[model samples]
Target: MNDPSPAAWLRPMLAVHRRALAAGCAAVLARTAAGLSLPYLVKVGIDEGVVPGDPDALSWAVLGCAAVIAVQAAAARIETLALARVAQRMLHAVRSRLFAHLQRLSLDFHERERVGGVVARITGDVASMQPLVAEALVNLVTSLVTMAGVAVVLVVLDWRLALAVLAVAPFLAVLVAWFRRRSATAWRRVREASAAASAEARESVAAVAVLQAFRREEVTLGRLAGRYGEERVANRRPIDLASMFFPAVEFGGAAATAIALAVGGHRVIDGALEIGTLAAFLIYLRLLFDPVFQLSELFDSVQSGTAGAARVAGVLAQRPSVQDPPAPVPLPAAGAELRMSGVRFAYPRADGEPGPEALRGVDLVVPAGHTLALVGATGAGKSTIAKLLTRCYDPDAGQITLGGVDLRATSEDELRRAVAYVPQEPFLFAGTVLDNLLLGKPGHDRARAEAALAAIGAEPAFRRLDGGLDTPVGERGEQLAMGERQLLAFARLWIDAPGVLVLDEATGHLDEESEERVQEALRRLRRGRTVVVIAHRLTTVTEADQVAVIDGGRVAQADPPAELLAAGGPFAVLHDRWLRSAAAG
Candidate 1:
């Protein structure tokens, strides 16, 4: 997808800031014009009031200038409020759109990226643009207006002096250009270093327990320190470069003022100008150089913000590898007759060599409402088949059909609604048990939730909790034991009542008691639903209506467990191993 152009992204923000920008411009023009009148006020006091020794005229002019200062101060307050409103509204819109775009991205995109980095881009990077548009841009615009007004007035007084001041302007411009380039490079480094540091910190904290258990604290701390050092170094370069700008610009400003003073003084001494006119010229020179210097610094923020914008836009620009068809296939109302025919697949690999092939020319079928068991050792492509069934990824070469419809043509929403996945380790979102269950089917009433729990033999266990359905399952169901979590997952799937169930059997983690309960729940949940179980347990394998023993990405044996065991094939050997292992234990 073509990302939103800079202009396109800025248009909405422009609209949000339009009223404030207008109000701010009016306030700026009024305040700046009032400020410029100060030099004239001094001129009047010096030439007309003080030269004639008229104390009354001097007092009146002083009072008038004070009144103007008060009005300007008031206008400044109003302008600050107006600009703040504009920036806040614009950031809100930008952040909302960025967050929405993130939601629309594919799951694969998230898997490949880090949560911390993505969050930083959306929340942190978008925030960086606020001051660039609000204070910096606004200040620059107002300063330019003030500078232009002063220049025009200065020229009216003495064209020769104005030309000299203009000569100094180019030197300031060149200085600004140099600073902007240096700051842009430094800011990019700062953002990269910060993101790397944040990613490291997040990873370390997430795995802190494991790190401690493994006695890897020193190693992890060293890595964290290294990242922090990089960030500190990156941060220091900008400050160091910025340090040069202030002193250099200050010196330039002082030099410009001294030059203007000396030249204007000579003219005054020659009787070509009044003392008041010399005073006004010096004031204008100060006004001109101050903004020029400040604006140079503001330019740095602009360049940095643009770089951040490009990074954010780049993420929003990516097209998901998997997308819904132009004309989406409607979901089947009833359970699907899921099939995989001569499927071959490989994960994308970075090396030039061919990728790791997970599956090869394997065929299988599960009729509507029938259960199929896929049994294999680790890395034997059992889990890959489940992912394919749900269209998590498309096979490299073959077809996956659901209810006689090709999955590639089906809408993701339709497929997800039709299929329910029970991963080996189930993830539970924060909320009450009831809330997590209802996520499967929004508006799932309590009675239905209770009924689903009952059907899966979870009611007794669930009732044991102090608050029944309202019991909170701490983060990721940490409050629940692995077996209890498994039961809840089954209950959730049962509540969803999907057309198909894909269960990755919980084998090693559960205790004997939890395993029995989950196995019983699995039996009940599988009834009347088309189910595919990636079995690692002999009990589940024995109960499956059909078993496919996968080896080297192909089905080595496919039969009823009893029939296959009698045949002394791959299934028989696995069955014997399970029995022997069980007997020994």
Candidate 2:
């Protein structure tokens, strides 16, 4: 709930995007200065040309003022274009940093935060910053310049009148400061409410079918309505306050104008001031009001953007829990050999509840080009072992080694190239069939991809498509069945050819026939690669050269499946239950 400091990020926008920043500033400054010339032109026209009854001079001055106005208009257009380019460049940098940081963040972070919230921050939140950079920033400087220029001209016209106008300045300053503080908080609430709504809506839509099937349509609707209602309430309060803001300022500015007229009119009537000079003073007074009016109207946008900027900076400020090593361990020439010695891990639990350990001093090793199957019931540290092997979360106590080198010393890029993991629920991006596959190996050609697809029995499915590799996959691969998605994920994994492969319930969704096909594909992929399979099906683990039974965060048994079955231990009970269940089904 703490807001990020704007200076934490925006200050660096200048250093990083120097050329764009410079161009934006130059354009805005030139335009603002040109705009400042308009009041001076009016003063000249009134005093020197219009007052003299000189028709030719009056015509020439009027035309000159028109020309200045046109130039100011052209400068304003150029400045807008320049500011837009600068804003886009800054947005690109912010998005790039967020993406790169996301890749480096630990799995624990992802588990703790909702996908909808993160997506909203990156897409919706960053987009809110456009007005800040493009309009608010440029106008802030321009308003300052115009205010200063008008004040100087007023003082030159008459010190007493200038001092009178300046009397209301303190009140304006107080109002700006007060509004900025209050409006910033209001805008922050608006953004938070928006993110909350986005997260709830995203979750609801993703589980729409479940909600309908469970007959919870009214419940879901009520929840959504509650969220939207909060958003509406939060939104209206600020708008209501902001609506009163301009009207108040206009009333105050008008009162100041009346006072100026009353005081200045007496000086003119008493022959103490020229008619032309008084006219010039009136024009200068209007010019003074222009900046104040602009400041009043734009405060809401400026404050809102300031709040959004703080949110963006806060997201950027998060330090990735997992980072690359300063000096990376070189890739082993003979491929990967994974070892875990005395590893332990525990998930932080609540104060009143028991803090359960997930992994406890577990030691295991998998030789190069071998398959290790971990068989256990739910919450038996099976998935935790897989996570540790990949260094997704470093063991609290012991060493994880790849090719006899400590994994903590390995560079992230090197580790990623050496290891590939397919989770229980595989995700597919929205793109063509080839696009998802290419993510596995960015530079891989179509021939290589097709070979991988063929290995996984996916080539026939690909051929059945209207455009083969060009066919689009719906969001999260909703277009394909679960088993088909798993097969496609294997095809992708095969193209990468990483030194180590970790499969977490890869065949969970497959029926007997589909499981056989995918098992065959997995077997083909296993050769010459280190494979770690977290298995639920007894039949699959029975095929591994070695199987380890995990119980209570420790390895209960480690041997070949046949040997473990013959011994009649924990694995025997699990295998029995799995077989009985399969028979029943």
Candidate 3:
């Protein structure tokens, strides 16, 4: 499946940049026409000029040959540049399209796929296709045109010699067929191995900190070595095939040349063929095999390209599970009550079968301008509720509504502006704090961002950030302290000013001092916003207007924080444990 051989993917892309394609085609035609003129001119020079001692004819032929060569050189240059332009355009389109598609795919898709494997699709898979666009296209068009032109000229010059050269055609066909079949399989393995190696390399780099902490560097190195070993074997198979295949093609050409010599020599000796005509026929005969050699390499390029294209196409084939309604209802601007009714969901396996339900038939409602905290043991579906509230993954069996509009029916733009979810660790791109804050409102004034940071008391730390707000965050904002990143995330929420907020353990990992800063930001952020907090520590829920105790994918109890403890129900056990843990601390 990874080796779809027809290059069906290329047609649509070529159509997209057809003007450049047309220019490249025109250049190719001119080049081929100019090139084919040479042998005929050679025949003219020797037979009519040199042999007959005609000085004018000889001079004319020489000048004509030089002029044709010049035209061919110019056309070749134009063809290369024009096709390179089309190739670059296609590459840009493919990368941009792939990146945008990945962004639009549902969160479930990203979670189900590994980071490294997904990166390989956009990076390695697209890279594998470069040769086909950059070089193979030109080679393919040139070789086919050259071969066709040469074949006609050879037959025109001497039919008997043409027959001799044509005898090798069937042999070349069979050899090419064998090479393509074997090389296709070989290249598919190579591509798969390459993807695997790339995945391992990226995964190791991304997790290097953890590996070093655990001192498992050697183990990771061994695994990487294994992946690379497989890749080396996969690459070797194709090289071995090419080594044999190309030499065989050369041998076929040599045989054709020998056959042409024997037949054409007899004809010239018997006064059936002119020496000049035999010379022209032989010259054109050599043109035939140049294409054969080039075509053989072109086949290699085709195999690599098709293998990569199939993988790229496979990614594009995915349909997002979460899609906007055909005609969406607009979310209301204010007093948006977030509600989930009898919602049920199961994380899907990679094979598309549903796994165990992460959220059961549960229902809840968060009154506008109130904080609802979800407290639960790990994997008790606390985070699942937050995810559903944010519409990262839609509930399978029920509807979530905002302001009485079904979240599915509401426009995503309206939904996003109405709700903001902050993960435990927020990600920042590799840029200045200003660049990351620009994500909230790309063209917003710089002074406003600085004011938001100061409002959250993050300005002092940010101002000290070497370049102030312009300091690069490094990857994922690792350059800043964890507390700084969390505060920056809150500033984003402030800028966007979503009416509903979902915080998943956002303050769970901070030091006491940093926690105070983040807690202060949360207080300012939660005012008048319908807040949903998935709390890992019960201490975080004491201020909540309401708390829901989740157990085994269902809400065990839901009530105000004080009443839940006074009720002495299932919430008592969790509250008691938190009290003792807090006392111990």
Which lDDT tens digits does candidate 3 get at residues 1-585? 223433565788889888988899899989988988998999999999999999999999999999999999999999989999998889888889889999988888888777887888898888878777878888888888999889888877877778878989999999999999999888888888988898899999999999999999999999999999999999999999999999999999999989988988998899998989988888888888888888797777778876787788877877788898899888877547888899999988877889999989888888889899998889999888888887888898988988888899976677888888899999899998998887879879899899888777777768777888888899989898999999899887788878888888778888889888888888887888898998877657998999998988998999999999899987888888888988998
Q: Write the number of the candidate with greater TM-score, choosing between 1 and 3.
A: 3
lDDT of 1 by residue, 480-556 (tens): 88888888888888877788988888655787888899889888988888889998888888888899999989988
- Give candidate 1 misplaced runs (Cα > 4 Å): 1-8, 54-60, 296-304, 349-354
Cα error, candidate 2, residue 224 (Å): 1.5
Question: Which candidate number maximizes lDDT?
Answer: 3
Runs in model 2 lying further than 4 Å from the true structure: 1-3, 16-24, 49-52, 333-335, 348-356, 456-467
Looking at model 1, how many pairs of residues clash? 0
Cα lDDT tens digits for candidate 2, 439-466: 8678888888889899767788678878
What is the TM-score (0 to 1) of candidate 3? 0.96
Candidate achieving higher TM-score, 2 or 3: 3
Q: lDDT score of model 3?
A: 0.86
My TM-score estimates for the predictions, one after another, are 0.91, 0.93, 0.96
Alpha carbon deviation, residue 480, candidate 1 (Å): 1.6
